[model samples]
Target: MTNVSQLARPHLRSLLMHVPDGILDAPTSVGTAVVATIGVGLALRGARRELDDRTAPLAGLVALFVFASQMLKFPVAAGTSGHLLGGALAAVLIGPWTATLALAVVLLVQSLAFADGGVTALGTNVTLLGIVGVWVGWLVFVGVRALLPKRPASVVPAAAAGALVSVPAAALVFTALFAIGGQVPVPLDRLAAAMVGVHTLIGVGEAVITALAVSSIVAVRPDLVHGARRTLAQRPLTIREKVPA
Candidate 1:
């Protein structure tokens, strides 16, 4: 059997990292930037509708948690490492609109302060992880929750499934961007397959982490979990009546 330490060593060497600039043609990067800008604008509008004094503080806390969690990388393959995008976790904890804003903030901070991703590629990264990842995961979570029992316990599994699928979906979006304007000379089919395969493994980690975090929060404060809030509210109040003794 392969040693677990050997599998984990590559992740330790490289801290949190993402696609750098100049890997894709200018047109692709610019196009993605436009889309990201629009997405952020829409998110801002949506957040206005969703956030209140009570929930706004939770959004800030979720952003900070996501930023810190992203710093830890884990091995996906022999040499490739991936970190939590935190899109699904944020969406489930807060709402998708707030989640998008939260993730965008995290990415912006990482790029400007730590240089974790390229400046030019900021929009691309935001489009892929912040917008696409959050929305896709949110959709999946909603769909799954609709099919399951409307209870807080169901939120964990739905969130986990959403996290599992979001990573590969984002990977495919990256592959499509590469196909459009990749600097490297590689076959599109081969690149897409490789990207999807590695990211699927990474998705398992994403799913586990998202599920655990959501579950912990739900256990203590179910109302704070946006995805589970409706179910929580629907719960019937129990009342006891004293009988004649």
Candidate 2:
């Protein structure tokens, strides 16, 4: 197990390096920056609400967990070992805004402190994994929830499907970014296809982890989950038994 883990790390880093430069455009960068800032603010505010009771500690734990998980890259096919893109799971377990903050912290730490990725490429990682991941995952979860029957059972599947799709969606975004400014010579079509294909398989792993995390939170503390809030009963109104006497 240790040998396998050790072998996979280099392959994962290589795949990340093959990614093209300047994929994160200025406009996209500004937008993600705004979203990420807002998310961090919201998380801090929410924590004050004794949402701290649930989401605060959980978010902290998840941020660290995600940061660590990304470090343990695993083999995908030949020279690529897939790493965790925790956007879907984080957003589903936390909220989109907060998930952004969580992932941002993870990415920042990975780049600055740990040097997992180059400092210059920080923007690319943030754009692909932080912004795209959260948006795609949150959108998928919301869409699936609307289509599926509202039940405890649906929660897992919704989270799972959302998680599964988000990885590929992010990969495509990265591919596009690469096409814009890739260093290594590779055709756009070939790059996009390879990225999307492998990441699709990788999504399964992401989805399973996300689903379990979501399911666990929903089962124990439904209020902490943004997606689950809809499934809950609204507060009843009782104004003097329907009207004033």
Q: State each model's C-alpha RMSD to the native.
A: 4.9, 6.9
Identify the candidate with maximal lDDT.
Answer: 1
Q: Which lDDT value does model 2 have at 99?
A: 77
Best TM-score goes to which candidate?
1
**Candidate 1 worst ten-residue window by lDDT:** 1-10
Task: Provide the global lDDT of candidate 1 against the true structure.
Answer: 0.83
Model 1 regions lying over 4 Å from their true place = 1-17, 242-245
Alpha carbon deviation, residue 226, candidate 1 (Å): 0.4
Give TM per candidate.
0.90, 0.76
Span of 10 residues, lowest total lDDT, candidate 2: 1-10
lDDT of each: 0.83, 0.67
- Per-model clash counts, in order, read 0, 2
Deviation in Å, model 1, residue 163 alpha carbon: 0.3
